[model samples]
Target: MSAYDAVLARQSWSKLTQEAPTREELLPLVAAAGRVADHSSLQPWRLIELRGDDRLRLGAAIAEANGDLKPSSKPLRASLLIAVVVSFRPSEKVPRWEQEAVASGVAHVLSLLLDEAGWGVIWRTGGHTRTAAVAAAHGLTENEELLGWLYVGGKPDGKRPGRRKPVDAESLLTRLPSAEGIAG
Candidate 1:
């Protein structure tokens, strides 16, 4: 599919099968997604793959962070969870926020690539993401911040594509006024 078509067809899939892309299948898509625009080439992002017992551990951590007696089932919703982390790099030229944006771009691009590859995917985030317990679960370092996780699995059998409302492109896009208008 063309880039435009792939993007237009992309949708978040909350219901997915237990099948997920293996490491060999996912690495190529991730490599492609890593080509996102980065100022100073500061690859300020990394992904952590979680499956089986790893997901259970994350669920327990999430439960502890939320002060809940029962572990959260959120992590088990998908066959795989890719934790998106923003690894801040010291740079006088690029601000921390810009680096965060670059990391976010990687996650978004990865989601698109996964969708195009016939994998069901959804980006999940919550208030507990920044909690100490959650961070420890992902083995995040002091310089890294958790953005979220991309939950991925196989598209369900005979599931129809999701319908999204048409975007109002004209309303969202506008040209800046000319110098004459600004002066006037």
Candidate 2:
């Protein structure tokens, strides 16, 4: 699909089916996402892709950490889950927000790629974004944020609903000066 068309067609797909992509298929998608322009080559993001039993472990960990926040065992298992982590290391030159933005951009591109591959994908983040328990399980740095998890699988057959929404031109675009334009 065309770049604009892929983005326009993309939607946050929460409900997924039984089929999922292989690791080989996902590697290219991850590479596509990493191509996002990060300030310098910091490459501040890391994705921990979980499938099968690993997803089950994550579901259990999430349930234990959240206590009663999520539903029961079956629904949480999912066909595949990807943890988008912001592995931040404080830098004198770069802002923390920018690092986080790079990571978020990676996740966004991956979502688009998944949609292009005809797989349902969703990004989910919560208070656990900065939680120690969640970070520990994935061996993330102490300062990292559990930005969100992407759930991926196939689209079910039947009536498909379009998610096109009215775009307000003014509300969508913000006229702002570049950092270089601002005084240091």
Candidate 3:
């Protein structure tokens, strides 16, 4: 399929099975996705793969932060959990927000790649993701922030493809109000 067609076909599926991509299979997909529009080449993003016990540990941290004593499986919904993190580097040329956007772009691209490779993937985030306990669990430094987790696994049989509201490209574009000589 064409690149655009692949992206349009990608969907976020929460109903995933334990079958998942190995590290070797996942590494190249992530590397390719890293080729994003990054200003100043700050490369401020990082990804952490959490599997098996690691997910349990993260769930424990999240549960503790939420005042719960027991770890829950809700955060460990998939066979693999990729934590998309953004580390802000002090840059006079680029703002922190822009750097974070680059990281977020990486996450989206990674999700698309996984979906194309027959993996069910979903980007999951909540208030707990940004909490100190959760950050510490992921070994996030003070300058680093956890954007969210990409839950990935095998898609169930006979599941329907994802659907989205068709967007009107024209409605999204706006022409600047005509000043006397502002035409471009």
Q: Which residue pairs does candidate 1 place in steric collision?
A: none
Poorest 10 consecutive residues by lDDT, candidate 2 = 69-78
- Specify the highest-lDDT model's number: 1
Candidate 1 residue-wise lDDT, 8-35, digit = tens = 9999888889999999999999999899
Q: Residue-wise lDDT of candidate 3 within 35-131, one digit each (tens)?
A: 9999988999999999989999998999988999898677668879999999899999999999999999999999989988889999999999899
lDDT of each: 0.94, 0.79, 0.91
Per-residue lDDT for 66 in model 1? 96
Model 3: which residue pairs collide? none
Candidate 1 is scored at a TM of 0.94
The residue-level lDDT of candidate 1 at 159 comes to 84
Question: What are the per-model numbers of colliding residue pairs?
Answer: 0, 0, 0
- For candidate 2, write residues 47-166 as lDDT tens digits: 998777776666556666677566336426358888998878668877999999999999999999999999988777777556565667778876777888888888777735346587
Superposed by TM-score, candidate 2 places the C-alpha of residue 7 at a distance from the truth, in angstroms, of 0.5
Candidate ranking (lDDT, best to worst): 1, 3, 2
